[model samples]
Target: MKSISFPFLYLCTLTAASSVASGNHGLYDVRPFTISLSDGVPRMLERIRDTELPDAISQYPGNEAGISLETLKAFRNQWLVDFDWFKEEESLNRYHHFTAKIENLDVHFIHEKSNEPDAIPLILYHGWPGSFLEFIPLIKKLTQKAKTSTGKHVSFDVIVPSLPGFAFSSAPGANWTVDDSARVFNTLMTKVLGYKAYAVHGTDWGTGVAWGQFDGFNTSARAAHFAMLPFLPLTPEQLEAQNITLNAPLEQFEEQRYVDWSATGSGYFIEEGSKPNDIGLVLYDNPMGQLVWIGEKYIEWSDPKAGTSPSVLTHNEILRIISLYYLTKSILTSGYIYFQNPLGQTGFRYNYTRARTDAPMLFSAFKYNVHYWPRALAETVGNLVLYRNHDFGGHFPGLDNPPALIEDIREIGSYWE
Candidate 1:
């Protein structure tokens, strides 16, 4: 492995008096920032090399049970021998980065403008375990002008922000909910960035924030797109009453997968939502521990063919995410949203009366996602104008299938009024 640097990341600071005048509510001066995980890499490498593992338990042929002991050993060996943090840092810094004061937090984001005259203002939101990094691959693709189906040339001024407490963004208060994030982000777009109207795309917990924008800020947030839906679907009986027929074989498979996930894979959801502090504190300074906790999700929730191909997320991609969390010292604060809005209690229920029918909505359903809702049932959640089903991707579509996700987002732009 290459020699590790000492200091982790360096931020170019701007004095408050020079950056923002007294009582100015807009962004305090969007300036260039660089990431150079200098100091943290050596310590993280030492920890990875010294990690202790227990004897492997006898199990099935594949990693169906969980991350096999062999997999863990391989990951450790890769970190010690092949993985390069500085190289990854350089790749990350290729995109322009900046930070601005929004609602008392230094919100970090990547703002890339298009040369096209009529470029659209679009914001992409990432969920937990994902940072602004997930959308980096899509920035160039989106910023270039391309013709839409209706002969309209469309390009975007893309804005990818780190959700509060995720990467470079400051952590939120304990009582913060997705609604609070929605308000702050809306302010970032309409007030700080001076965009009167914008569109949005979200996945995972980001879907919740996008929902808030659709429901509450519909005037400014004109159109929205989601890779995941935040609300639950109607029961089978309810769907039957509405004369909706589900494809039997596919429904069976989806149901079984959902049941299996709820039974075996919801432990993290329970822990993170109920006791975020415990897990967050335990893994705060432990790089290997963060890897195990987040790596399992990247492996299981992604497409089955992820690691075998470059198109989908690979082990190296997973390592980069874990490294980001560890170096930022944000593992603890990142889980705070789970505590603020318990999954089952707040956003999980199905309610027809409270749907976001104000704005035009689009959805891209990756077949392997842990949860599933047929287009028939999904359309009821909002004014769903487009629902495209994809057979190749999974939870993190931005990484699992960037080309497909990019196309879907462009299609949404065509539908934007």
Candidate 2:
């Protein structure tokens, strides 16, 4: 990977006033959003499955390059015969869905209010190849007041947004980066939701947005939790240079993952970041391409047995995610994120100064995730009030380990109370 110069743009701002803010134009209504796909899509998708997919599979039999033929076939059969988009839509509507105009785009989000006294208002952000759907499993748990082992009452009024250019949300401008995304999301929580201050939690690309809030709107973003640690870990040389001593065992377990991910797992990032349009255009009309592209992540990044037999996430769960991108015709725009913010071999290369804050922050380090760090390493990024290690979950913890994730979040909510 060649070093590409990043022309940094500073869009970071810090403001948390309670006064209602209208964009250049008046604020649009936060109206209910319905997840209805066009009627023709189901039949059309079925036709493609029955015809095009088999031919592609036959031609690329040893496509061990990506999702195996058997897995693709299973998804196709289930999508055609068993998967029910109507039922999934109904289940999605069980929560409050709404869209409001933010920065000249319709920003879609799930805003579930809790009646529990002093419930924390939190905005949970999801990363790429993930929708607001990732947080659905934990929604009901967080929205209702529950007692912790210590007998403390905790609940949250949760807001989960589809990142701009993904799923139901409108796409940002062609030049948008995570920083741009950060600003828009800050406006959403403070001005649209009418919350003076709130907590934030995120994983993957959502972590960038959460970091944005903490960096730009510290007054409004009171606390944060991250399933994906954003900043890179300190190298042994850096530790020695800074004369910092380690208190905990140097986690060679995490070090090995870094080596493996860098060597074999970075192709998608390069293609998406460098030439998003190249692949996005090719896959624009190819639903199978979209599924193969995104589905591969679910298979590789998630726990190996998660969607397999005794599936933690069933075939239906897998199909629902892919189906949304296909139905909405937004897969291209979502994939374009890589093009806008190109990551190099080292990792994310952003030009803005690292946003440091004293606000309480928590980090959940799951073993199977691509990146892991010790509590001491995580502390350098923020207030680092809590760091918990988990043995079983992988990158997609919302699905792989929702119960554990929810419990950790409930524990964090106690700080707000």
- Judged by TM-score, which candidate is best? 1
lDDT of 2 by residue, 7-91 (tens): 1210011022111222321355455556777574765476556555454566557645668888888777777888788888788
Question: At residue 171, what lDDT does model 2 achieve?
Answer: 85
Each candidate: what lDDT? 0.77, 0.72
**Worst 10-residue stretch by lDDT in candidate 1?**
1-10
RMSD in angstroms, all models?
5.1, 8.4
Compose the digit string of candidate 1's lDDT tens values, residues 345-382.
44554554345446778888776677777777777778
**If scored against the real structure, what TM-score would every candidate get?**
0.89, 0.85
Best by lDDT: 1
Error of 1 at 35 (Å): 1.6
